[model samples]
Target chain A: MSAANPGATSPQTVHVPLGDRSYDISIGNGNLAEVGRWVTSLRKVTHVVLISDGNVAKYYQQPVEDAIAAEGIRVTSLGVPAGEQSKSVPTAQSLWEAALADRVDRKSTVVALGGGVVGDLAGFVAATMTRGLDFFQIPTSLLAQVDSSVGGKVGINLPSAKNIVGAFWQPKGVLIDTAVLKTLPRREYLSGLAEVIKYGVILDADFFAYLEANVQPMLNRDPAVLQKIIARSCELKAQVVAEDETETTGLRAILNYGHTFCHALETVSGYGEYLHGEAVSVGMLCASRLGEKLGVFDAESTQRQAKLLSALELPVATPKLSETAILSAMQRDKKVEHGKLRFIVPHAIGKVVLTPDVPSEMALAAWREGIEDESA
Target chain B: MSAANPGATSPQTVHVPLGDRSYDISIGNGNLAEVGRWVTSLRKVTHVVLISDGNVAKYYQQPVEDAIAAEGIRVTSLGVPAGEQSKSVPTAQSLWEAALADRVDRKSTVVALGGGVVGDLAGFVAATMTRGLDFFQIPTSLLAQVDSSVGGKVGINLPSAKNIVGAFWQPKGVLIDTAVLKTLPRREYLSGLAEVIKYGVILDADFFAYLEANVQPMLNRDPAVLQKIIARSCELKAQVVAEDETETTGLRAILNYGHTFCHALETVSGYGEYLHGEAVSVGMLCASRLGEKLGVFDAESTQRQAKLLSALELPVATPKLSETAILSAMQRDKKVEHGKLRFIVPHAIGKVVLTPDVPSEMALAAWREGIEDESA
Candidate 1:
């Protein structure tokens, strides 16, 4: 087992500055033990509806319940089957009823203790149950640790679309224990790196260079490297989120840089075919290539990301799906305003813009070019 | 059919002071005719997903749709069955699917044009769909016009609990037309007056006294009297809502003066046995009696409310049900914390406070007192 170095294991807190909704994201290696103290520090919680999933419960639910129970705070722990399917309406309904049955009230706090699916589902329940409850997140997966946990995006999917029904309900605090990542399977672990890379490419040039330099350490799961990447990604994402929490301003859309292509790819290829971050990996490259075609971004930067993604073992090639299907999927996104293509094409490694009205043909051409690059 | 007198017919706007969530309640005899203009005046809306129920649609959907369409705003009208049963998960799921099918998007405004049921069900949909869409309300029922339209409490019931699953989603604007109340059944209209009277007793002594003076005119549906009651009721309710929007500060609980008894009555007696306002009427009398039993309130004030409620055609008599059943039902209310009864009791007209831990026996005694008044 790769232990995060003592220095890296030291707790780091990232404060999401959302005014009244602002909360700290405590990131560390072994701070899971401090959860009870950590939560009570935020608010006077007497009852907790702790939600988790089957896979996560095997490793963590006990320590969590014990830690919270130790605080003299009553804990009602409920677990659902693990995986993407749990992010559905039925799952949400069951959780709502379960929490209510166990005596959840306006004063009760909901603590989400699992991956992105659990965070999203649990957060949605907290948002609507009793018209919002104080929510705390103990995100367990690498994908959640750096991305979903940082943002307040939580919801369930409809059969027709993923994340079709949801609310941007922020958590009171998020606790990310890096030690848990040691238990994450290889594919899921690497998929998370794609999003970690996303922050650097979209916002910070220095972070991108750091990730570029730390390939070997990152590959070996060096605790120091993992801590640095996770903390830096959260900080960058927090800055963007604080600036545009509700996405009312177009400023928040920069975070969706490649999401258009990513969503299209995920939809056209079917959801399970690509874990979200994996599609994001392939999607980012497509967005980068589209930038190159637009003449604002260079091929060197595109190649740089390609090399990094491939080194990280995330797929870089566009799948062999019909271009028409992909295009229709993009237009179908409720996020897309007026059926027009607004691509978040990166201008350089660190900058991107929400470019509007790039013809459907141009987007298609960008996809077609990626299909030709065998190594990409 | 009673039309609002021309003078009372002039639009009276009540502004709910909730910072950015603040919106005006525009009440007039015929403001429904200008719903499109009223909506556009509040926000830049291009598309409207107008939600109405079967009963409301029979009277007002087309005019509302045409008014919006005439303003060059696209309208997608949807109709649900008109009743309390429609405020359920299955109904919400169906509405979500139907709205998405009609191209509901982030920019699409959701306009709820019905009673409390449609307002809440459609509002909950707008609150969660795409993480919330701009919502407007055109409440068509007397019960909705003065009460539900002002506060942002929107949700659905779990068969186990009323409003157990919901969100505090505020509308961008709410338009209420008193003219529509002319079509409201006599029973429903009288039921709505219960809430109108509640505000006077809970917040404003002046309004309460005014209501006393205008009883005959109010019963006659004098348009001038109608305008005074509806406008004052909204303003008072808005003041309480703005002071404690999400009910976190305990100030909002004052609005629930009789809700504990009313909810338990509705739950135990089976919903629809009494319209919400009718139950509220009986519940208020019960609470006043509880107040009198506790020595803080005078019997004269209790008798005054009883007289007004009876005069207004609302039931003041407690239902013939088992005392234990009512006690258990109140304990089961999600609003009741830790099984102790927290009653919102009046010390006098125009002032109420949330009193905690009034013994279950005392509450039952209060209920028993109401049963003894033969004329109540």
Candidate 2:
């Protein structure tokens, strides 16, 4: 971990409550030089666009732009070009004309220093350059410190939809450090332990029996079990994006338990083939066999979530491709409704529900009982 | 004056309030076939995505997409390439890949129709496509039925900033018809009577002495004085956009009284040569001569708004241009701050204020006391 210890400790915060678009996420372990007294202690700063990602600004952008220019706060930074085709729309219209040619305005303050495509393209250039600004998120990676930096779902992506252009905006603060997952790469830290065993199989069953008893001290990267599983997956995705911040109260589609077969196996086996928590570990065994073909789960809870996602090495089967191209990419999912198919499923371990209109031959017989059938 | 009288009369509502993003504008003359029962009487929509342009989809997109597909909703519609270079970013990325190839999800319902560049590019494709949608506005001109259709602001534009990229979203309804200003073009209906005499110079001296006692029934477009000056300029811009909706309460920069010399005379007279209410009728006489060179207003109410914007034909002087290119285009506007020069001025004619740090030789001596100088 590219050390910059300004006296370590004090971090785990969380608070995303969103009334007046709330803030705070923090979390620690050498808190990357306390990102300028954690964003000028939430709010009044002069200027700081920041944004990063030429591979996390070649190991954390000069000590995070010299700890946000040692608080006089006039940073600018900028970087892009690192992956997922830099989340397009001409790289968010050339980062909104390069943050309006580096003079950003409306009391400038973007931050988003890299990972999850620099927190969804710097939280959509701070949710539209001038129409909005004050945003902050440090994220770094384990799939953006437990699911795209505690949710105010910012956007960009439309080569025919995927995050299909966005903005729920919310940030004001979100640091996360886990000492930059000690430079990740162990298959992207076991593909962010498949969304940390999908928040212990959808919302805590003793954090899914404490990740099946810290599977070998979470496969030996144990710094206090990675700060108690990334602060319990950012307090279970800031309590489902503070009770559905903008998923218009369908209680945030039970945090998309295995994101509709991990976004139709990351859109028909093609978007950097897995590594979205290894397609949420093969979309949590096709939503635990579509919760055992809707008899509300069990087949030994889909072999205890495929022996804890094959003991955290991940990919619990199901990628033999074309089940009519994974049901036409789960009928183009942001939880497709008007054309039907919706599913959050799981029932046993720490429960789940959002199962509406599911019968397409019972979700293709729960993706042909996770294949290996060979017409048997 | 294309008449399609679906039994006219009943419209005049206003509402805007904001709690739960409150809405309702209605106003009428022949309620464009009650725009699908005033947007399905507020919400349970099905699918709309209407948008529009190509010059208001050639005389109103098939009667507003056949009156919202004759109330069975599901419209789709699209269209672009009409003006302000189709509020760019490659026409909002080919309109988010043609509204996700006409299947725009998240409970689709955009509408927009036309004018104010098709309600700011279909209210910025109903605020960032799927991140927001439930919108509606039929505005068809009179500068978007009185100021960008009751202000939920939506955006796009950045060949170096102009609506830089946007969203304030808002619009569950706002029909306005005044029979589509009888197909406008009388110099865009006297440049929308200079923002309907700038909501009577900022907020209504009896709607600016009732537009100086209805100038020949508002130069004879008089369909009940163009529905009483577009319902009193959308009830004074929906009461300053419901007391400052996202222009962050400097009480919405007193609706930019002569918008800082009408955005520095629409940026040194180059943008479609002054039809933003004829550069707010010459930036409301250079903000009423910088409110009479800061002795807080009166050149007998700036020649009573220059004899009601020259009896409604507009362009009341000051366009001799280069006063250092209209003070470097009013210090690159979204109400310039950290570079000083903030404006809005006029303190009488129903008051106005926003002031802050002004001096650049008293706003260029209120732009050289509006030229026509001839050394006197």
Candidate 3:
């Protein structure tokens, strides 16, 4: 980790060391404007396939494209409809064809300029086009900047599954501009904070406390606080990814602390009903309660998380969805092995364990207990 | 390289040493029956997604599926039409969906069980399904056994491009049964020999001489010679791939000795106009002639290749397609850099160099000289 300046607003670099696939994530207040210099500084680029979503393209695509083009690089700006629906095979194919139509060659680089959907889809295109092209990331959304953009995991979703068809295609560089969060819708911004809190709970207790203390600044979109949390989240993730780049060792499973429950909630509730991190907020509480049920975690820790999540304005209570459906979706999750359930259950803040073969009833109870009461 | 038995009839294994990504190619007569044992010996398996083309499924798919199923492993056999046309986005998507419908999971392995088209399409399916499944190759065609199956380059084609979308996804193991070639149509079988001959031209002079001496046995598809040539070809290709796994280093370009011209001919003449290797047979001569034009190669070497290719009964004359279309196609080749024509030019039998800055006129002249004389 290195900061270009000592001040909180200055650009910071978090190096993700994965041998030959290792790269740096540059975090700053308004580094989006430095997109041109950032890309050229990493590698020579004659052509770029700049991919974004409709919502993102309006605010950021033009400036990002212009920034890169200012370096005398030809940028092919492409956009898909906003939201998760665009992260499909059809969209991936369209992007591939569009890039090809623009004469994107092996020499051309792909730069993902939107949120996770764009990052994952565009990364898949980069990974497959001409066997692969160099890729860079300019993640616009907080969720992407802190999570998807840092990891090499990129893919399109199958209709039956989310994040199912993809590859570990690492980018040459990731440029995160925290200033962009200012334009993000208030709810979406809050949804991202849930994940920011996840890093602290999973890896660093001190960082968790920092986040808890800075809720107001985070809500204010304070550049200093944003840079710190985003940088720390990326650092925590990069450490896990560097150890297990492909998740082969299961060391990476710890990052999925609440994701097993998170995915189930999102699926059973129907996607788009719960934005990912919002569901993650609800899911974390469920997992925490499950941990308490399993006797490995305490109620106080769960309450602590619930308090912080409520304060951050993210959903702390799980919605009223079918418990059976949630359980079934959890069973169908990629995490379940040999018909047995597995979850990343927390023992304490900064310490989680991958607990396997937990009884279905107990897991279901965790979800059931979190339901909000209509009478209340 | 190691042989299970010293005799030529016994299975020989060409180990592709790519560290953790390494796997072996097993070559023998009638080894297809041993497919079950071979795959299980490599890794643990519960479910297998067997992908093949319609042309091959009629003969081998049943036995292959039965063999694997006999081992108590579930086998889901999938098929596509038997031509290059099936190597497209729609075909790939259908395979993905079909595999998912059959409950394909992260633990399931994908086995490609046909020629190059099936091998490539299935391998791409394997590469992407669940972000990559363990892949095994059962190359029925000689072209696949010797070339496509050996390298990890697997992908589908876009309507506007051939193999423009793909990944370098290696198979866990490759089972090459020389007996399978017996059912191959003659023209297609001969087309495969063109690639086998290419291995000798690019890297192994002794192998080249051996191929030249064993022309009759090769043409007859003699069991021992088939195993020897296929094993030698895999060994040669594996060596190149091991040195430059992802084409990052220039070493892998040597494997594309005739492919630049081959792709151009395939394109301008329309894709189905020439089977890939038939085009290669013509392309290699053009390259040999280009080498001669540049004064780096002797005409005697060019004649030697011509004689071997002719004796192999492969096409030796370039088709009369539009020269402009051919030139433009060549320019569009992934090999061309900065608008400069480049090619793998042979300096001698078993010795080719990736020659850059090749003048367009000279490349055209090479193609022109190979044009058949209708007057005669």
In lDDT terms, which candidate is top? 3
**Predicted complexes: DockQ each:** 0.82, 0.27, 0.83
| Predicted complex 1: CAPRI docking category | high
What are the TM-scores, per candidate, against the unseen true structure?
Answer: 0.96, 0.42, 0.96
Model 2, residue pairs in steric clash: none
Model 3 C-alpha lDDT per residue in residues A3-120, reported as the tens digit of each score: 3224878788999998988899999987889999999999999999999998999999889988999999999998999888888999999999999999988889999988888899
Instruction: Give the DockQ-based CAPRI class for model 2.
Output: acceptable
Return the DockQ of model 3. Answer: 0.83
| Candidate 1 local lDDT, B1-376, one digit each (tens) | 2343445666788889999888888888767888888888889999899999988898999999999999999999989999988999899888888888887778888999999999999999999998899999988777898878888999998987778899999998988887788888889999999998899889998888888877888787776678778888888888888889888788988888898899889988988899999999999998999998899999999999998999898999897888889999889765577677899999889899888888999999899878855465
lDDT of 3 at A26: 94
Instruction: Write down the worst ten-residue block by lDDT for model 3 chain A.
Output: A1-10
List model 1 lDDT by residue over A1-376, tens digit each. Answer: 2343446656788888899889999988788999999999999999999999999999999999999999999999989999989988889999999998887888999999999999999999999998899999998888899998777999998876677788999999999888888888889999999999999999999999988888887887777778788889999999999999988887888888778889899888987899888999888988998998899999999999999999999898887888889999888764566678888989999999889888889888888777755465
How does residue B138 of candidate 2 score in lDDT?
86
Interface RMSD of every candidate? 0.6, 7.9, 0.7
Q: Point out the higher-scoring one by DockQ: 2 or 3.
A: 3
Tens-digit lDDT track of model 3 for B64-175 = 9999998999999888998989999899989999999999988899999998889899989888888889999999999999998677999999988878999999999999
